[model samples]
Target: MKSRHDMIERYIGLMSGTSLDGVDAVLLEMDAQGKPQVVEDSFLPFPAGVREQVLQLQAIGHNELDLAARLANTLARIYADVVAQLLGKAALPAAAIRAIGCHGQTIRHAPHAAYTLQIGNHALLAELTGIDVIGDFRSRDVAAGGHGAPLVPAFHQDVFASDTENRVILNIGGISNLTRLHRSLPVIGFDCGPGNMLLDAWCQRHTGKPYDANGDWAASGRLHQSLLQQMMADDYFQLAPPKSTGRDLFDLNWLEQQLAAWPALDAADVQHTLLQLTAHSIAGEVRRHCPQTQSMHVCGGGAHNAALMQALQQQLPDIRICSTAELGLPVHQVEAAAFAWLAWRFCHRLPANLPEVTGAAGLRVLGALYPA
Candidate 1:
């Protein structure tokens, strides 16, 4: 085995998941298939009007390809600035980082139709930061007939696998997904549905905060049974595994429609229902797909929300609900670390996608390599 110092290479990970709330950047060091030691991480909120513009383009009421392209450039600029910030904080030069692993801002995530787009151009990120960049981490899997999502399971397996034990790794980003890893089989994963995506939007609409703190707003209100039932009826929930979805399927309009059908319900009732929808859908999917999932280890921003965690526990009492913390990783930083691992895989020319999970026809190397 390599010495500890041999694992001390620097790498930066940049991510803007379906929530689109902000950018998450992290610096980490770890050997291949080893525990990542986080050196530093920071969240840079999108500019005041920036997130809204992306949402407008994502929402039902817009026509602006030009706007998206410009926003892409702006996002890359922000990424570059953050890299500078990271380097400054770490007391390192640009040359120190082995690579910049970027998931980018997902503008359109439609894998079934055979194409997906994540802005924040790697070309620009590479040029501005003077660092090698790896991105576009999903398309090749889609080309192979996979869901092109829940891409972190491979990394999770690498970092979490043991000699003779099983684990379920749940990532609750803008959308929620779970990775069930075990010895003697191909690792598998799938999207469970909205995580913080709907909850964050609901809170912003009602209280002006970016998100519901621990789902406190949801706790203040009660679920609107009508809306809950209607939302639970969504066909997406019933679709088989090997499925993937994004803001395109579950967004403000989607949530609003479920609310509109039950016009008499208060906004709090709507918020309460949304939270239940997230928790229940996730628990239900895990039960359906990974019944052997003994313990569910959570990650992403939503894992810290107490109310949502409580709701999930109520739905799946048979399974233990825990954070990635219990598994030796921080909840908020797992996805960020995922891209870092993806970059490592790319640098090694290793296949980063699982065909069964992404619906890919075969093992494929995901992500494009951009030179410094």
Candidate 2:
């Protein structure tokens, strides 16, 4: 007979971040103590057409309702396919997993409006996968007077907190965010600013690539001081914590507006400046709020960018910076694993949002379930 700790409980987590790149799915196994380990992982990239459609839906567009609903259905199908692949890789039936925590594609995130929307129909996902699906993880927090963004800090505290060393978990997806984990202080996190969002947009427009691989294009150009300063002057950077932003503020249109003043600037230089902007914005927040953070473990697509990583180290010479891989979790797996943990919390009826981090009136159990 196996002890309670030896019994394996499984959950699936699905995440398609603001990057508009793809969905990451993971099969996670939890122990009796609620500790989770990644047993299997899979990724499904969005086709260029689907990626374009999602980006188009970010702003108000033609036939809004029909387009959104149709795209939601499409996303659900993609999500179901990912679940199928995960189950196949694990060689297990859907009945073996308790639920899937899906952080749907976030097209609009306006916390001040007291609403945030992430597409991908959970009911459809459940119907297709034969597993309970937990989604819409942000609305409850937003309804509770919180920024329903950066819901990963609570999960970060659970899995990445250090009792002996002050640590910060930095996730650089389409939008960069940081979670400070101090031994004595409550966990706090907020979006720092543009991560790969601007970089990828710029690279795609100039180089026709989705992103500047390893930030080599940026590394090739010199940083334009004036352009960098102009971009940094936005009011969003000066705002206090308990605040969050998305493409709602920092989109390609916003970047174009910034560049309207520098019509003749070189594309590589702009890319370099954008990379520095991400690094500086993130470093500024870490210095301002987590002054004592001794180590920062990075997780997300941005971690794989060598140029950006070097820039971060240069921004903070005293703090050690490394990838989450060093901590036993790969860069790309962190966010997906977070959703898995969030699903587990929801299933257990545990409050998964940190009021301190999201500025909710109080803790709230996030994510609504769609039973199969």
Candidate 3:
């Protein structure tokens, strides 16, 4: 007879990044050694209206409290639907899953002010899915006096670290973050300025597409060196580690402000320059911090941008750069799966946040659990 204790415990990780694109969910299984194996992954893009509302809520506006609460409920339902789809695809019952690790949509992340908000009602999700839900994973870290952003480096260390080589796990979502991994060193990580956030926003405005596919539009345009230099001089890029950023600093308004100087520049040229800014900012951090890095494994939406990849390779010719898919996990699955690993850690009462990466007072277990 199969005993409950001897059965495999499954966890679902849900993430909706700053790109405001949509939800990404993944079902994961952990081995006896605490390594994660992705069982299934799924993505559901936000409706245009929903996406717009979320973007609006990023900045202060009238009746935002009411709007944010309503949207949180809507996101919970959306998350529940994704959970249902994952269970159906895997042929598993809700009871078979231990808990879900959900990194809800980040409408605001102000760690310096001592708060970070991610809204997807975990209690409602628990009731709707009939599975335990663990969420609000960042607030506690912020309470511990940490940035509470870029929480995936600990997961990167667990899954991608190699004893024989120094590696950097670069996740370029709406915002880019890199984890510096070495066999004998503490993990170092921080946001690498903007990633697909500015590019996607600019592309959507000019091309009407959510993102620039394969950098086709960017390749069609010319790179403006002056604009790139001006953007690269932003204070955020000059800040030391223990830092993080989102739409709060690198949104459409910020981009427009930068473009205001060059009133006659081509839109595609602006986009091309933005792409270079992302590549340059990321490369600058790697060269400054992880100079000994042998290879950089990239994941997230930016991994698909050929022009950006070429620019990164050009900037750091000494190191090898490739998609994280080369390392066991698929490019899109890394962030979602990291949340699942976080849930597994929470279930075991283990500390998941890296003190070195997030600058917390010390190691701490993240997330709040809502039982089914």
lDDT of each: 0.83, 0.93, 0.91
| Per-residue alpha-carbon lDDT of candidate 1 for residues 1-372, written as tens digits (9 for 90 to 100) | 988676667789998887776788888786655456778887787888888777776754655777888888999999998888888888889998889899988877887678887888789999999999999898778777776787888888878776666667888888998887756556778888888998888888889888898888899898777777888899999988788888999988888777776667777777888899999899888777776666888998888899999999999887888998887778878898889878877887889887777778888888888998
Off by over 4 Å in 2: 1-6
The positional error of residue 180 in candidate 1, measured at the CA in angstroms, is 1.2
90 in model 3: Cα distance from truth in Å? 0.4
Model 2, span 1-372: residue lDDT tens: 898745878999999998989999989999878989998999999966998898888988889889999999999999999999989999999999999999998989988889999999999999999999999999999999999978999888888887799999999999999999988777899999999999999999999999999999999999999888988889999998898998889998999899898899999999999999999999999989997888999999999999999999999999999998888899989999999999999999999999998999999999999999
lDDT order of candidates, best first?
A: 2, 3, 1
Per-residue lDDT of 102-182 in model 3, one digit per residue for the tens?
Answer: 999999889879998999888999999999999989988999999997899999988999989899999989999999997
Candidate 3, residue 86: lDDT: 88
Clashes of each: 9, 0, 0
Instruction: Report lDDT (Cα) of residue 221, candidate 3.
Output: 88
| True-vs-predicted CA distance for residue 52, candidate 2, Å | 0.6
- Whole-structure CA lDDT of model 3: 0.91
- Residue 317 lDDT, candidate 3, scale 0-100: 95
Q: On lDDT, who's better, 1 or 3?
A: 3
